[model samples]
Structures are given as structure tokens and as C-alpha cells.
Target: MTLCLLTITTPSAVEDVIVDWFLEQEDIGDFNSMPAFGHGSHEGKMSVAERVTGRSRKTMFQLHLSLPTVERILAKLKKDFAGTEIHYMMSPLMRAGDLTAYEA
Candidate 1:
């Protein structure tokens, strides 16, 4: 199985919901999330405050999983979070491991 990084961005309004959803997924071992700002004129997506600042509040979730697992999770996300301004991207992971375990 090829390892890959999956990133999902969502409106701040549904950040908790997204987190809860991820927790329910058995395929996911763990994930990381942080508050972020999305900069773009996405039309009808930005709130008044966001429009003034030219960036919308967003929450980004990232996880490392196998290629097939990532695809399956993405498909499930598409069906469950439809119309929720949820966006995602996946990138291949060349390597991931602990760097301090090596003995000189």
C-alpha cells in the first residue's frame, strides 16, 4: 500500500462536525487539525468579516494513509459533506518516520 497525505479544508462553522465525523471512521488511525484562513473570492462563501479581511475562517485536517484508504475516505466525505464547502487534496508521501531512532 502506497502512503499518501490527505488534507481536507472546511468552513469553521462545521469544524466540530468534521472532527466528529473523522472520529467515527474506523479506517482513520489519527489526524491533525488547525485553524486556518482561506484567501480567495469564492463568491457567496465568505462571511461579512471574511470579506472585510479578504480571507475566510477555515479548519484544515490532515492525515497520512494508504492510497486506497485515502480514496475511500474522500469518496465518503463527498457523499456525507455535500454542499458544505468542504475541499480536499492528496499528495504522495515519499517517506515518514522517526529521525531520532538511528544509532551512529
Candidate 2:
């Protein structure tokens, strides 16, 4: 099966809600997330402290999924997270697998 990588970055303040929303998606099997620092020139999106530091705290989630799945997920996110400062990007995944599953 073919797959794409969907990366979503959201404000740290809404991390919990974002995570919960992901967990509620029955089509999603698993995903990876971590604390991230976003450095951008969008002054309107940054807080005073972040502006001074030139970096904003964010939560990033990545999922390896089929193209159709990615589209569906993105549509849902748009509907549910409207008005929230959520950023996303998609990349074509050449391959994905666990090294441990390989034989020596």
C-alpha cells in the first residue's frame, strides 16, 4: 500500500485537546508526537515572550497513512479545529517499516 506523511503542528496550549481528537479517530492506528519549537515571522501568531525569544512552543503530530486517509483526516481536522491555529503539511512517503521486523 502507498502512504503519505501528515505533519500537524498546533499551539502548546491546545495539545491535550488535539491529542484527544486524534485518539478518537477510529481510522487512525498510531501516530507520533512531540514538543516542538516553531520559529516564524508571523508576529500575529506569537505571544510576547515567544516574540522576544523568536520561537513558539508547539506540539507536532506525524502520521503515516494512505493518501485517502490523509485527506479524510485533514477534512475532519478542518471542521473540528476551525479558528484554532493549527498548521499542517503533507509529504509523499517512499516507504515505512520497523527495522526489528527484518531478519538478520
What's the lDDT for all of these models? 0.88, 0.90
Q: What is the C-alpha RMSD of each candidate to the true structure, in Å?
A: 1.9, 1.6
What is the C-alpha lDDT profile of model 1 across 50-103, one tens digit per residue? 799899888999999999999999999989987889888999997665688755
Instruction: Find the candidate with the highest TM-score and give its number.
Output: 2
**lDDT by residue for model 2 (6-102), tens:** 9999999999998899999988878999999989796247878999999999999999999999999999999999988899999999887699886
Q: Which ten residues in a row have the lowest lDDT in candidate 2?
A: 39-48
**Candidate 1 ranges with C-alpha deviation above 4 Å:** 98-104
- Tell me, by lDDT, which candidate is best: 2
